[model samples]
Target: MAFLSFGSKRDKIKKMIEEEKFDEILKMAVKDKKALQALIELLDDSNPGIVGDALLLLSNVLEINPNSTRSHITPELFQKLMALMERKNPYVRENAMLLSYKIIKSFPEVASQHRDWIVEGVRRGLTEGNKDQKGFLLMVIGELGLKELRPMVEELVSVEDKVILPFEGKKWVPLGDIAKEVLEKLS
Candidate 1:
């Protein structure tokens, strides 16, 4: 469907998400560039159903078209999502974390320029955030291979709870095993 002609505006937006039409939604999302603002509004909708879908849609769009949404990853979005990490809603925090992770992966140079904010965000999420959120952070850290984050990963290992690496089809394997194997070879 044409980005602009998707149908009743709201339904069209929802349909774009449901159909995983990242390209189309992204095109629409950048048109006027206000769609990003609209998507941000849905992030706080009281309706959990709408909020969850919105977050997922935002995350997916950002992941698929990082360049299109790069501008949306302003300091405001960073601060807002980091604040949402403390919210009672796991879904919100999880999606927010994933969005942050994707942004870091897609734009490592930009992320490096804002290392302090990214590090602080991950630190808070690692300490006070939910288990799932912690897992996401660990995965991001591992993917980035940032030696600077080694201390955080080391600290995580001391906990009785193990952080598992997410694998294909959502299965998880012990992160400790992965780390140990890598460390042994490095040493």
Candidate 2:
């Protein structure tokens, strides 16, 4: 009984993912607040690989069952995600932003209710120098489809920091130009 209460199942989920047992992982996570909490806790693990895998699984689970997943998506969770998006690790930050976007996209009603929080989160994610994350933020902004982001989008209009992003294999493109393209799409 003590083992059952104190044991971790994250390793199992990771293993299942390794074995391509997505159905099993989904069965373990979907509509299960406890499992969701466990997955969230896994995000804090020191291993970036573990954290990335957990984020991917969580995103998949939430996408499949947003209505049920909503119970676990509180204001605190969103705030924590905002912080995660600023992580030094680009891979982790990318996964975090992707998961955050999935949550907001799946539940537009929640974003509508918490417009201020979501907008602030978006602003906070738009840091300079992180070309990849800034691009991810742009994609999230597009997914959000919120006109309230106009001010934040305008803030990028004058940014001259050039971040070379890979395109078509060998072609590296500047982020400043991409920002202009995204701004045009927003308009």
Every model's TM-score: 0.67, 0.72
Q: What is the lDDT of residue 45 in candidate 2?
A: 80
Give the per-residue lDDT digits (tens) of candidate 1, residues 141-171. 6655555667767765544444432234223
RMSD of each: 5.5, 4.2
* Residue pairs in candidate 1 whose N, alpha carbon or C atoms collide under 3 angstroms: none
For model 1, give the 10-residue run with minimal summed lDDT: 162-171
| lDDT string, candidate 2, 1-187, tens digits | 3445556666666667567776777777985666767788778788777787778788888878877688777788788777776677766776787788778778878877777877776676675526565666665676666567767667765666555322232125455555566677777
Clashes of 2: 0
The whole-model lDDT of each prediction reads 0.62, 0.70
